[model samples]
Target: MNHPLLDQFNQWLQQFEQTGSVIDTTRLNEWNHLMDQFQTHPEQLSSNHAQWIKTLAQNSKAMMSVVEALQDQATDSSEQLKKLREELHQFNVQLLLQQASLPQQMAPLLFTHTHLSTLFNEEQLAKFEQLKSSLNTPQFEKLNQLIESFMQWQQAGQTLTEEMNQITELATQTWQEQFDDSLSAKDQIELWGKIYDNTYQVQFQEPSMQLAQSGWLNGWADLKLAWKQLLTQLTEQAGLPSPEQLDRMIEQLDQQRRRIRQLEKRLSALESGDHNG
Candidate 1:
């Protein structure tokens, strides 16, 4: 009874009995039932299903196109980023190469600056004048040019230093105004002390002070050497005794005086003995 071929034969017999035709009556009944279900035409459902499939196909194509476009954009962006990184790396390498040579390039300039500074100091001018006979006109002119250049650089440095000091003072004043306005006197003192220790002392004032002190010491040493050289030349030219020669003469005089004193003591002792006899 449950055999599928027999069931089909029965359906054929039922359709033959009803309409004199061998149509599948069960399928026909199902179509009729579906037609009665909705007020619209049955073919409209098929048409809607077809339209839905077409729309899904179109949407799928459009989504695939968008995905492809996004992939292309991502590839382009990645390539551009790679190029940018490569350029940056090359620029950094160039900067490093320049930095490596900077110290060597600056060394001779620093030496000239210090040398000109040592020679042109106002305190050493007198002794520097004494050196005039030793130098030619060209040498003096060259020295003057170097001194002028050094002075220009020094003036620029001083201007920059003043600007930096002003900035620092302004920043400190701003900080005080912002945070210390309501502080107690003792707290304000502590705040300033901290600020000095943390910022101004370390960053500005202390280094500047140390640089000035070092310059003074170096200038003093150079001045002393210049004075010694000047005096030695003057003494030699004037036919006056040098310091070493003067020391030797003083040593001889001291020895002669000691011998005279010893002789006088001996004579005094001899006289006393004679008187006692």
Candidate 2:
């Protein structure tokens, strides 16, 4: 009787033996013992056990491929972010130099024998200079701050991604180190949960994560506000009630319902008093 499983097991054993450094001696011994048992008492091999083993092998391979893909994506994104950060830094430097040279560059146009110089007197030129100075007002300062903040947010996002990749790799290594083939599916799930909890705890303490969280929250809030504004504009354009108007209408309806409830309570109280009398 030719046993397909026995043949397969023998092939696996032969491959494992050929690759001497693939597994430790103890692990190799364990595989040899299992092979021996399978061959000696083929009837003792449970279909359930075989199925479980096959499923576990498939899942492990799938998980490893997913981890590798994620690692590659993170690496690529990190490289792109590095390039972006460098470009942004260069752009900022150029922008600052251009801003600094603006007055000097424009002064020649206003003061020298140009069309503007012929058209405007000294007083008008002074007013134009004041107008130029007004560009450095509080609003412009806030705009500059917003730009700086956006840059910081991008840097923080990159840092957070790098930290996450490191944590993922560490967690994967730790899980591999602690993995036991003898453990049941439930036990493996519990082990994964513990690994996830530990990784999250470590990640939560990271400064990059905190900055990224804040940036995400702020961005979400801004998005919501912008969306609301857009909705309000659309509603107004369509001659429909805006969000604020709808809110006020809902509030008034609630107040009217409360007043009606109060009146009903008073009427019931009066009727009860009359019946008592």
Candidate 3:
């Protein structure tokens, strides 16, 4: 009673009519009714092309869905790969920083064991060695901090030494403003005391001429006391070590003192009132 073959024949006829050929709804409806009547009988006709085409359409949709799912996975994989690469780059940067610090961490130990060890204390040597042996993750952290502090101190000491040299040169060259209007009375007094520091004896020549000037004689004794105190503080500040450096420094001071004393004596003799100017 089912006449699927006749059904297909009528469907093909309808497609043919719709393709550039005129179609009449009246005739088409009559044909469709006849086809249905045959199809209902169950023994009219049969064909495989229409069912195969229907199955192909369903398979195509499933294949498209699978392709879209694969694309999404690819995009997700790309994002994950980017994140992993950035993490790797950060790890490399951390490794480089850690590597750079290794030498500084080892310097104190190396300095203690090298020929420079003779210049350092036995306690310092032992401490550095102990620090080297105790570099575990859970040990006392004071050793690491000490090493870092030592490095910073060494750099600062070098910088201070250079600045001190420049200061000494400036002080010596500016001595001509000795005690006049060029520098304030206070500044001149301070500068004079700075030079006389570490020198042997402060000999005054022709004290009578100096006494003749009003207020000068009284100020002289007080200035001498002030100078002696300033010299003591200067020596303490200079932090001289080793008796040899002290001896050499004293010799330099003696030479300058001799020159300044002779100059003062000659000037005082020339200014004498009881003799020729």
Candidate 4:
């Protein structure tokens, strides 16, 4: 139906058959030239012309064969290119399937599925199959739908992740406002229990909420580890809080307090004795 290359093929055929072309002129030129050269020595000239004509005819056949070979090679190369493109397209589809997440991974074997592949009609498939067996138009149409659906799924994931992060941040700030004070071990445990109770009471929409919760100490564990590491580094550098020295200082201060109280009472009793005297 489409005649771009076929018309060109026709035009080339016309050129070959035109005036002064080999296909027509070569047919009788050898005999005519030989006769014109040897009108006097007919026998010898006729023998030599016979040999020459045979050689020329063979050469023409060889030339035509070489041209035909080249044409075959060109057709082969075109077919190879079409096959390679179809392979690349199939690879792209497989890559999409590999990259799909939970919701996206729901639809499988898309090329075989009617809802996805129905977009391609018979003509499109025929054209595609003539090019390569791996990718008919139906497969290609399904590939398009899968890619579109996967992209939408990815966008949805991104939106959900952003919302979760916001919720995590809000939860962190609200908890800090409520319980951001230094408490003893008992009080800390009690407050943590209260938070655990509140978090347990709320129902979550995310099906994977339990998985999220496992990672969730709601960000507290990460913050604690970070600050503890920082403090450890600072304390090592300051060379303070040696346990033996703290205990020794506490003992000496307690002894000094008891001795000073005794001295104060003894002085008060001496003053009363002097007054009575």
Residue-wise C-alpha lDDT for candidate 1, range 181-235, written one tens digit per residue: 5789578657755764465445445566456434444444443344344445557
Q: What is the lDDT of residue 4 in candidate 2?
A: 62
lDDT by residue for model 2 over 1-277, one digit each (tens)? 6766667667766877798736555654665555555645545455547655555445555554444444445657565444434433333333322322212332343333211111223575456446546667664543333333333433444444455556555665677688797999679869966985698688779787677556645643443444455456667779998977887899999999999999999999999999999
Against the unseen true structure, what C-alpha lDDT does each candidate score?
0.48, 0.55, 0.45, 0.46
Clashes of 2: 0
**Candidate with best lDDT:** 2
lDDT of 4 by residue, 18-95 (tens): 844554445335433433433433334245475664555455555455444444455685554344334334433333
The order of the candidates by TM-score, greatest first, is 2, 1, 4, 3
What's each prediction's TM-score?
0.24, 0.37, 0.19, 0.22
Query: Where does model 4 exceed 4 Å of error?
Result: 1-137, 183-277
- Best TM-score among the predictions, by candidate number: 2
| Selected candidate, larger lDDT, 3 vs 4 | 4
Task: List CA RMSD, all candidates.
Answer: 41.7, 19.8, 41.5, 37.3
Poorly placed runs, candidate 2 (over 4 Å) = 1-170, 184-190, 201-218, 268-277
Model 3 residue 256 lDDT? 100
Q: 247 in model 1: Cα distance from truth in Å?
A: 11
Report how far off residue 51 is in candidate 4 (Å).
94
Better of 2 and 3 by lDDT: 2
